[model samples]
Every structure is written in structure tokens, then in C-alpha cells.
Target: MARLEVRQSWLGDVLGLSQSVVSKRLRGLLPFTGPELLLIASAMNISLGELLGGIVNEKNPHPVDGGSSGVAGGRLDLPTSRL
Candidate 1:
């Protein structure tokens, strides 16, 4: 959107999220909620399916965990672990 000259604040307003939250999502620290993604798609004039087609599974958005656990609130444990 930046390349298209879209304002970050406008995008945040459209998604109903704070600018900081949007920045976190852009930095990959947090994932966008389902509704937020849909709003983003609308803002970009694209369908939700096309917006997330290859990035996420359209059939089932919440993918299976496959038994892999992580840190609190779905954030992966990225710090170096002591053996």
C-alpha cells in the first residue's frame, strides 16, 4: 500500500486496529484477525479469498497445530534455548 501511496493511518482505521498493531503485523510479530484481513481486502479492492489465497489456507483459516507447541499467545519461542 505504501508503494500505492496509501497512508498507514488510513489502513489502520480501515482495519479498526491501532497503528502500532498494524506495524506489528507488518513486522510479522502478530497475525491479522479474520475480520481485519477481510477489511484489508476490501480496502485494497480485492476479494478476501484472493487477499489470503497463497498466504493462508482458504478452506480452513485456522490450520491444525500438528502437535507443535509454542510460547504464550501463539507467539513462537524464538530465544535461544539452553540444552
Candidate 2:
């Protein structure tokens, strides 16, 4: 959030959570839910893919492993289900 000058307390307010909860999530003590991620992305004015570091432009389709999975490590890859 340093890049955008977003503070934890402000993010907590945006997500309707406490600063401690946001801190825990930021420190990896707790995981961020899908809805929470969406809210964070919306607040940051970025797409969910970009927030998750999973955006893959067509020009550089094969970045991490010579595939276009979008997700670099293939760890947070979501299933192709329509919303």
C-alpha cells in the first residue's frame, strides 16, 4: 500500500474490518476472503487479477513458466467458473 499511500486503518474502514484484522491479513497470519479481495481491488482501483499479481498481457504471455496461466506460480489459480 506504500505505492498508493493507503493506510491500514483506511483500508480497514473500506473493508469494514478492524485495523488489527487488516494487519493480521497483511502479515499473513490470516487469509483474505474472496469478497474481501474484491473489495480491496475495488478500493485500490485495480482489477482482481492485478491485485493478485496474476495479470498476463498477450505480448508477454509466457512469463513465469512458459505458459499463459496468468498466475505466475500457479498457486492462486482460480477455476474457470463464470460468475
Model 1 error, position 58 (Å): 9.5
Model 2 spans > 4 angstroms off:
54-83
50 Cα displacement, candidate 2 (Å): 1.3
Question: Which tens-of-lDDT digit does each residue in 1-83 have in candidate 1?
Answer: 64345655677788777878766665558755555665777888877556555444555454224213211233321212221
Clashing pairs in 2: none
Q: Give each model a TM-score.
A: 0.57, 0.63
Can you give the lDDT of residue 17 in candidate 1? 77
Rate residue 60 of model 1 by lDDT. Answer: 42
Best by TM-score: 2
Summarize candidate 2's per-residue lDDT along 30-77 as a digit string, tens digits. Answer: 666666767878999988767666445565443344433323443333
Sequence-dependent TM-score of model 2: 0.63
